[model samples]
Target: MNKQNKHLPNFTQAISQLIALPSISSSQASWDQSNQAVINLLSAWFETLGFTITIQAVPGVKGKYNMLAKLGSGHGGLLLAGHSDTVPFDENRWLSDPLQINHKDDKLFGLGTCDMKGFFAFILQACQQLDIALLKKPLYVLATADEETTMAGARFFADSDMIKPDVAVIGEPTNLVPVIMHKGHMSHKISIKGQAGHSSKPANGINAIEIMHQVISELFKLREKLNLSYQNEAFDVQTPTMNLGAIHGGDNANRICGHCELDIDMRSLPGMKDQELVSWLSKALQPIAEKYPARLTITELDPSSPSFQQTPESELVLTAEKFSGHSCCAVNYATEAPFIQQLGCQTIVMGPGSIDQAHQPNEYLADSEIIKTEQLLAQLIQHYCF
Candidate 1:
């Protein structure tokens, strides 16, 4: 079971190599980088382990890629999946290089160490212990791109239906707990255009900020409606919520405000349709748009991440709970599970590291999690693929 004996990199080495490759996914152009390097590294390692490597260029995305490494072949098996990209990190906030794996305080400190290029490293180590020839069913390791931003990689791969497994496990830093449910996310931008004029002649120009005030008022009412309409006791936030994340308006105190923009984020509970929510949002703002004529516009910021929920009694959930010794729970964060589940596989989010550490400066995974997660992955492979 020793990786060194098989001539493959050990756990620390694997994670270190992954950490060294900066595959950051951000909506901002300056922060985003290609995930092809990480994908290539994973393909090389898994290829060494006798898995067939399929490196797919995520359609329409210039530099993103998804790696699907499969061992053996069959209709049903285990799929260990996670995203290849990490969120943007701030170097000044970290005590050590965020791109290098620093082993300190019994933890592996680095960007993406736990959320979750480290998950791929764990998979590689676990596969090193297994005999691929004995696998009765296929074993798939999926590395996707843009999970931190639009989740376009997962959406493309899942929609293609290239492969299907009986179960899918997304390693999304859930602290090794079986996460059966989580909310979805969608962002919207509302822009208002108004004529500019001298501040003394307020009537000569349409005030975009003043119009935005009415829009905000209506948005509050919509939030109240959502709170009253949806409730899930399983989540800490029992109802769907919306936040006005950003607002920008005109610059000068001497001039009338000519334009304004508002960015909003909505998190929906399971069973709430994304389009339906958009429809409700449009309905709420229709009056303002009508009153303002061509001055108001509402647009979706990016692809929506639909909420995900797996049944409590499902086999995958039960198996995960049994193996991890924790009951299935819910999280507020959105992951790629919903799209993967679209392929008709039983899916759950259970992985090493705490979500609390993800995306934070000096993010890390406890060294103890290495063995524990490797063991758990090995057990799942034995049960599902052997």
Candidate 2:
């Protein structure tokens, strides 16, 4: 770590404080919590580095904020971005308290270690000894809210039309590799309504479970069509994919089913819109919905992360690939990179740790990744900020 970086204490102290804070964001009220304290902590650290910090309260959100810290001055520059909130954890499932950092097995275990409050610690380490005065372009650290649930923070930032940096890197746990492309994610639940009646009487009432079978059939057909139509060799799946995750309905086996709910999620390829998937599913279920005269309604469970794809030849992608010492590839997970790219910035998804470790029981970050990320971030800053 650079000796001049006084704004943040040692990495252990910073990561410990971040993990100690509980900022879980979820659609369910029971699991959802405020991120205000986390942002404030980050603000306090950045201000020590002479950064101009802007804490914007996310409108309509109860306790959320987006922190934008700028050092130096210029029209366009590098934006180091990461989300502040983490997903809810199961208490019984963890070996140690998720709120406290655990050092075991030569790894640091805690929530948000790699997905990714830890990335901000890397940013802090990178900013040390930086002659801010010599920087030709401004350097920005954007800590956003609610990436785990709705991406409300990133969406709100894009809607606000704030600073448009020339390049951005979202540290989203990519095993230290640069990811130039990824699929979009959308999840929806469809509720089918019907009247309950005796199973012995066929005409007395409609069977919602039976109706859903037709819905599933049409969905499979649609899925087949989508698979054939969209293909990207960059991704392992190559084609758009959908999963019928869950279904719930009825009470007794002897009684006619009154209602049923189907939940599904899909990942779309670049140049493809999630709205199209929603529309296609609705149309596929239209015939069954009309035949049974049943009522069906759909609700969005996810905030929708659009596909991220930066041109391979772009300066930012090339530079990140070179610095990381890995070729750019596509990831299966969606990220806030699309939202950051929406601000007229070329974005790359790169960070320490593996995606497999994220959201798992007792998630951990390898100790080696810490040192590697610090050095890589310093190089990226010097190449882009100076």
Best by TM-score: 1
Candidate 2 residue runs with Cα over 4 Å from true position: 1-7
Estimated TM-score for each candidate: 0.98, 0.97
The TM-score between candidate 1 and the true structure equals: 0.98
lDDT of 1 by residue, 273-321 (tens): 9999999999999999999899999999989999999999999899988
Cα lDDT for residue 72, model 2? 87
Q: Number of clashes in every candidate structure?
A: 0, 0
Tens digits of per-residue lDDT for model 2, 80-183? 99999999999899999998999999899999998899998878767875877789988999999988878888999988888988999899999889899999
Task: Give each prediction's root-mean-square deviation over alpha carbons.
Answer: 1.0, 1.4
> After TM-score superposition, what is the CA distance of residue 307 in candidate 1 from its true location, in Å?
0.4
